[model samples]
Target: MNAKTRRLVAASLVAVTATAVLAGCGSADRGGSGAQGGVLKLWTHNAGNAAEYDVVEKVVNDFNASQTTYKVEIEAFPQGAYNDAVVASSSSKKLPCILDVDGPNVPNWAWGGYLAPLELKGGEVPLDDQLPSTVGKYRDEVYAFGFYDVALTMFARKSVLDEHGIRVPTPDRPWTRAEFSAALADLKAGGKFEYPLEMGTGGSGEWWPYAYSPQLQSFGGDLVDRSSYKTAEGALNGPTARDWAKWFRSLVTDGYMAQKSGSSPNDDFLNGKSAIEWDGSWDAAKNVEKLGDDLLILPPVDFGQGPKIGGASWQWAMSSNCAQPEGARAFLEFTRKTAYFLEFAKATGTIPATDAAAAKIPGYEPGGRYEPLVRAARDFAVVRPVTPAYPYIASVFEKTAKDIVAGADPDAALDEAVKQIDANLKLNDFYAD
Candidate 1:
């Protein structure tokens, strides 16, 4: 079989497995008893993340203590294996009533009938108060919500920028494309670091789309046409997209960034190996600890369409097969309290979803050290494409981006990627409305 055929076959196998899994799980009446009576199983992707797991455990314990009607039992899975475990359990009709889903996958799982629409009454955490990207919606209905979300930013040291005469950018006055490139050149000229910028290219999987796609969008191109969600024909391979590809490749070719950066880009930044690091808000606390007052969380540069950053983090949702959705919803609602949001943000070093929650957190409050992150999320965040075909889109983009950065012809690689993406969307009937 040809390469396309192999990819098709692999995609087909995954679809068939997903279908079987959904069918098996859907056939049962798994939603447990009502809100007042029985155990509600909750699964989370925090098995190895001790700090996050502790917060989840505390929430479950608090919920059980607060209610006589339901007891929530918890199961944790490692982030890498969580999705597969959920799929396998779903195939066997053994999925938990409540589970945590990565924000981007919420649309896919909900479309596949793996999740139920969330039911929230008026004045429950004020959905309006939460960051726009934290609420996972599909087809105009919310399927999940998260207490915290992460923001992407360019990390640098104020002292380095000041010493080098590089202007520090902020949310209101972000660096223009020319200025950003000039800064990189200036940093490189100093000969103080191995690379002027660490793009975190060593990270794999979702990190590719999450980290780099925003740069494409900022250049006035997108993964797919949002108006129809039908194809990536013009969007993925358009002129602006080509510019993004070329510029991205130039970073490595010009030696401004490493083609394959070290394992921990943040560590490298702290260790003075790189002048700037493009990373997530989760690294803010550590960067601050090491750099003290010198740490600078600068806004992303504006290539053209203003600055843009990836949004949405892990969120909670009810399983379609859950017999006790109300019970599960109760637990979710309880966990959305401001105190819990503050607790999770403190524990995970993530941005709280709500303003009220942000106020309670030390560095996240208004005018605090990490407050720029909240502004970044509010002003520049862009959630990944909300389509059932997103997984395929992300995978294709990841491979094509890596190829482009490795010196593949920009137009040719993107064109081929567009072709593959179009084919996948068509095969799936455009993931029809």
Candidate 2:
């Protein structure tokens, strides 16, 4: 089944299960005395990620030890289930004092009255020093900030590219649309691998928008127009968007990539089953382990608007219902230290949030092995739209894109997507105040 069907099924299951689970939870009393020498509850979507959880625990421990006024108590949830849990919590008015939010969800949560504005004092972490994509802003106010962000790029082995006579692309001089297409065609003509590229079509959920929307943007199309933050109309279904759709579907039709690639594209690339893999920085360590000096981390193709990649990862935020905003803000400020950012990036193998933090990380600094990722995040990253309707917009795009790939007419699919997105925006009154 396609991703849209899977998502619908998952949503049905979550809806059926959430009611029973949330029934016993107590409502969050927003009127209580603010963290009066008491524990401030925190939530994280790192239940199974030991390395990341370990760093989080260390930060919490340090924060508690350094303060006598309030202590932090944390609850961990698996990433897949965390959003459902948060939604249930919000419905029951039982959100924690502080929580880690996925970047795109910030606007949704904040708009739903679940997240409060994160007020960081001046000189906290030099927000300007961080990549633009790492800061989550809604309605012109900062709602969340992440410790690290990931960049998307094409992964290949130098030997394979050299053997195929394909020109390696760099951040400064990435392959244009025609050049990229020709390269892929040449690589496929060799017929050594099943396909020349693995676009990670097998992955679902946010991966669809995170990986593919940038390509759309590069084609002068967008999920929605940022000018008004109100509609997907011409931006999504325009002539340029149709061009992006046709080119995207052609990747499969021309046999340059699989309609449904292997379960693990990175592994396929490492195992020599594919020549190039479009993926994120999270796979860098494992790819390096397998390919060693043969690894070639190439930039995303410049479709038209000069190469673009989706940005923003997990970010920390304060709950709007938290009575202890001061305590929550204190923890946020405490964790903003460059040292902690370095630690998190090291533990998570993600690009650090700030230049200072990046400088501290070994492979992310200037001339380091993974500096290409840093440059990509710095030069090409574009955060998903900051509107509250992003969730609906993303779903619409995913379904439309999947249909377009599955032989549905691009114009019709995009028109339907734009209609749905516009309807959603209207239902929420454009999420106006």
Candidate 3:
């Protein structure tokens, strides 16, 4: 799509405006004794996930109706502008009582003392049944919570597979890179598709970490060490990294995948231009609507080692400066417990966080058309490193991958990334013995 078209599409997808309340939220200041006695602000950007806003509206309305101590005002913000607004709000102490924070933003907000630590309140739902990797931690503290979990998996048009007599890949037995390359070649030879795969472009490391990392991990590579911030000591610069870089460069160099124009791969797949699109399960709902019921998904390509891990945690955190930490905790508790979140996930195509919720969720099956795509969240989930300096480390990984794909030397890119990461660690006083 052209730049103008892309922007238009993006704007359409993310047009969310949060309604704010100025007065009658109670006269309690943030830290005043009236902590539990004011208007609470809640913000989120998952409008595309589901259309059941009324379900949540009822839940919040119920909470408001049931309480006299505080009133919660819920608002929706455009996903593109959400983070900036959060940052700006942090500066003026205008931070909401509850906010939807991305995994990467967890550490920054936590360490910067912009958010309050969460404390489970009365009537809080048990999250022990949730995926440990999904609702677990941010810098060793549980800040945000997610109801829907997403993973990167392969997507194919059933018509294309049938036309080429190609077997769809499965989770237990996924296609090898060689097999994938052959399938793409066959499809193109028959004039079925212009490119074999639709790769993601630069962003908040969403699609790249999900769709692209699998190829690298198939070859035993990784973007960054989830356990440690150091790239030199871990998996980012090893043989796997080099092999992965070569594989990616081959797509552009060998004329399989098209040149990266910074377009969304999901759109390409939906429009029938690309046969295979590497993206997260988060796009499943829209794809199903656009591409039809014949959509077949494959697990991450198995590179002989094992399936690569791909998925990110969406967390909810309390502001450390929150005037009513107790009230904030209550809000988080309500979000997780009510039927609101489960219904919300069903609409969005996100994997449910809790196993019980996952099981109780209507229409969840073992191995069907949409199963591989949804179950990918369970089979190949990998949490990004939970550290104060992770944003810097994540940047290093993204830049190195991009540079190597653009023809820069793999070893050189890794080395530079390592230097930057190490410097960030030291600069942040995160140096270890």
**Candidate 2 residue pairs in clash (backbone atoms < 3 Å):** none
Error of 2 at 385 (Å): 0.8
lDDT score, candidate 3, position 351: 76
Summarize candidate 1's per-residue lDDT along 113-188 as a digit string, tens digits.
Answer: 6778988764357777899999999999999988899999999999899988999998989999999999999998
Q: Arrange candidates, best lDDT first.
A: 1, 2, 3
C-alpha TM-scores of all predictions: 0.92, 0.93, 0.81
TM-score of 1: 0.92
lDDT of 2 by residue, 1-433 (tens): 3333323332332233554435323432232223435678888889899999999999999999997988887778777667776777664456788889899888777777778898888445877778888888888899989999999999988898888888889898999999989888889888897688899998887899999999999999999988998899999999889999999999989988888877778888888888889999999989998889999999999988989999999999998878778888888988888888888999999999898999888888899999999999999999999877787788788888888888898888999999998987776667765
Q: Is candidate 1 or candidate 2 better by TM-score?
A: 2
Model 1 misplaced stretches (Cα beyond 4 Å): 1-37, 122-124
Between candidates 2 and 3, name the one with more favorable lDDT: 2
Cα lDDT, model 1, residue 170: 84
lDDT of 3 by residue, 1-433 (tens): 3333322222222222222322312222243222444767666654443464455566678788876777777666556556555554554465667767776556556665556557575544576656655563645666666666777777888888988998887777788778888887787787766677777654445545545666666687665565555544446677877777777787877767765644566777887878887777777767777777788767887776777666555566665556666776766676776365577667666777765666666545554445665566776766665565555555567667778778888778877877777776655456221
Kindly report which residue stretches of model 2 are placed more than 4 angstroms away from their true locations once superposed.
1-37, 122-124
lDDT of 1: 0.84
Residue 320 local lDDT, model 3: 57
